[model samples]
Target: MKSVLQIGKKILLVLMIIAVIIAGTRSIGMGMNIRTPKNGINVSFYVDINGSNQWINIYGKDIDNPVLLYLHGGPGSATSPIDYSFTRKWSDVYTVVTWDQRNVGKSFDKKNAADKITKDIMLADGKAMTEYIMKYMGKKKITLLGHSWGSMFGANLVLEYPQYYDAFIGTGQCVDIAENEERLYEEAKKWTEGDEEGKVLLSKWSPDKCDDTQALLARSEIMNRYGYGMMKDGRDYNIVATILFNPNYLVKDYISYVKNIETSMEPYMDFFAHGLYECSLLGKYDYKVPYYNINGDMDYQTNYEMACEYFEKVNAPDKKMYVMKGGTHGLLESRSEEFSGYVHDIAKRMASMK
Candidate 1:
C-alpha cells in the first residue's frame, strides 16, 4: 500500500549506508597497523641520519634473536616493499631490519635537497644507522646483508668498520662498474642477435660510454628485453606492483616512491660519472669479519661470473659464494624460500655466537 516514491526513498537511504560502510572498511585497510608477534618486535619508524631523513622497518619472532641489518640495493632502489616475502622466515632466528636510505623511496621528500649526497655522506649515514640499530637493540654487533648497490655500499661499510658486525653477506653483488658494463654489453648483444633495432641500440652503448645516462638506461632495456634484467621470471612492472600493494606501505609512501624512483640516483651522479672509485669493491678483499656472496646464475645485472671471480679473490676469516641455480638478479624475491633456507643456516649459527 506504500507509494512508489516512499519505497524508492527507503532504497536510496539503504544504498548510501552500504556505500559508507564499504568505503570506511577500505580506508581502514589502507592504514593497516603493524601487529607485532607475541614477545617480539615489529616497528616502522623514521629517523634522521646525518641530515638525511630515512625510513626503517624491523621485525622478529623473538626479541632476543640476533639483529640482521638488511641494506637494500640501488644507490636508489628501496626493497623494503618486497622484503617481507624473502626476509620473514629468518625472523625466527634473526631480528631483520630494512631501511630506505636517503632521498629514495619512503625516505624521499620533495622539499629536501639531495644533490649533496656524496659517497662520504652515504657512508656516514650508513654508520649512523648501524649505530642506531645496535644501540636500540642493545647489541654490540649485527649481521649485515646487502643486495646489489647495497652490496657495493655495505662491502665498503663492513670493511671500514669491521669490528661492528658478526658477518656480512652480499646478494646480487655488484663489483667493478667499468667491467660490469663491458660484460653486460657483450651479453646483451648475444641475446639481441638478429634484431636490427636491438643492434642499433647496442651500437651506441659501451663500457666507456657508461657516463651517458641514456646509454645506461638502454642497457637496462636490452637486459629486460631478454629476461636477463631484474629476473628471468618477471619484469620490472611486477616488482612495481609489489611496491604499490605492499601492506606496510601507506598510500603516501607508494606515491612518493613511484614519483622519485627513476631519479633517485641523481644525488651521486657527479661522483659516479667519472669512475668506479666509490662503486666498485674489486681488488679490496680483505675482511676482518666473515664475508659471503650469493648470486643467481642468470643475474646479468651484476654479472654472476664477475661475482664468482671476485668471491675467489676475497680472503676472510669465513667466506662463501652461494649460487641460486637458474635465478636472476631478483632471485632474492623470486626464490625467497630457497634463499631463506641458505640464510637460515647462516643466521642460526651467527645468532648463537658468543
Candidate 2:
C-alpha cells in the first residue's frame, strides 16, 4: 500500500509538470507561429521624434511590395497591438507599417507633459516618420492608410506632401468635426427615444451646448453602450481581450497601454474636441495623389454622409469611394478581406499610373 501511494504521488507530479509545459507553450506561442516569408521584411523598432522615442512595426511578405503606412485612430488610442489580426494579411501584399503615435501605446511618455503635445506636433511627427520609413525601405513614396482620427492626420499629411505618397486611403474618414458631432448627438438622442437610461445619460450633455471634452466622452460612452459605436446586431467584440492576447505586447507594454490612455486623454480630449471643428478641411476639394475613401455605410462615428460628401467634392488624379454594405466603424475588422482586396486593387491602379 505504501509503494502504491508513492507511485500515485509521482504520477500526479508528472501530470502537473506536463500541464505547466502546455500552458507555457500556449502563452508564448501566440507570436511564435508568426513568420515573415522568405525574402520578406519584418522589423520592429523605435524612431526618434522631437527627442522622444516612438514605436513602429513594419512587416511584409516581400520587401519589393509597395509600402502601406497605417495611421491608427484615437488621438490617444494605439492600434499596433491588434495589427496582427488584420494588418498581417495586408502585409502579404504590401509592406504594412503600424505606429503608436506619440503619447499613446508603446510610445507613451510619462515624462512628456501634456501641454507640449499638440496637433501640429503629432502631424510633424507623422511626416518625419514617413520620411524615415521611405529612407529605410529605399522607397521614394508609399501608400497612406488612416482610420478614424488617423484619417484626419493622414488627410493633412497627404495635402501638405502629396509628393511622398503613391495613394491615400481614408477609412472612417472625418470631414467636418463639428457637424459629425452634432449628427452623433442627434442620432444618439433618436436611438434612445425609447430608452430611459440612454436619454438620461445623453441629456446631461448637449452636442451644441457642451464643449467640454468630458461631456463628449460621457456621450460617447452612452452611445457605445447602446451599440451605436462599434457593436453591431447586439454582438460585442472584446477589444481589451484582443489587446491582452497580442503576442507582440509584453506585460509592461500592456500596462502602458492602459496607463497611457488615462494620462493622455485630458490633453488629447481638448485637441479632438476643438481642433477637428476649427481646422477641418471640409471645403478643400483637390488632392495631388490618387485618393480613395473606403467607409462603412453604418458608421455613425465619423458620419458616412460627410465622408461621401468630401469624396464627391475632392478631385484627385485617380479617386474612388467604396462603401461596405451594413458596415460600421469597425469595418476594417469585420470586413478585412474585402477591404484588403480594395487596397490591392488600388495599388495595382497606382502602379499602372506610374
Number of the predicted model whose lDDT against the real structure is largest: 2
lDDT of each: 0.79, 0.80
Query: What TM-score quantifies how close candidate 2 is to the native fold?
Result: 0.87
Evaluate residue 310 in candidate 1 and report its C-alpha lDDT on the 0 to 100 scale: 88
Write model 2 residue lDDT over 79-122, tens digit each, in one string.
77776677876876699998988878888777774755566787
Give the lDDT of residue 335 in candidate 2: 71
> In lDDT terms, how accurate is model 1?
0.79
Q: In candidate 1, residue 198 scores what lDDT?
A: 88
Deviation in Å, model 2, residue 55 alpha carbon:
0.2
Off by over 4 Å in 1: 1-33, 211-213, 235-247, 351-354
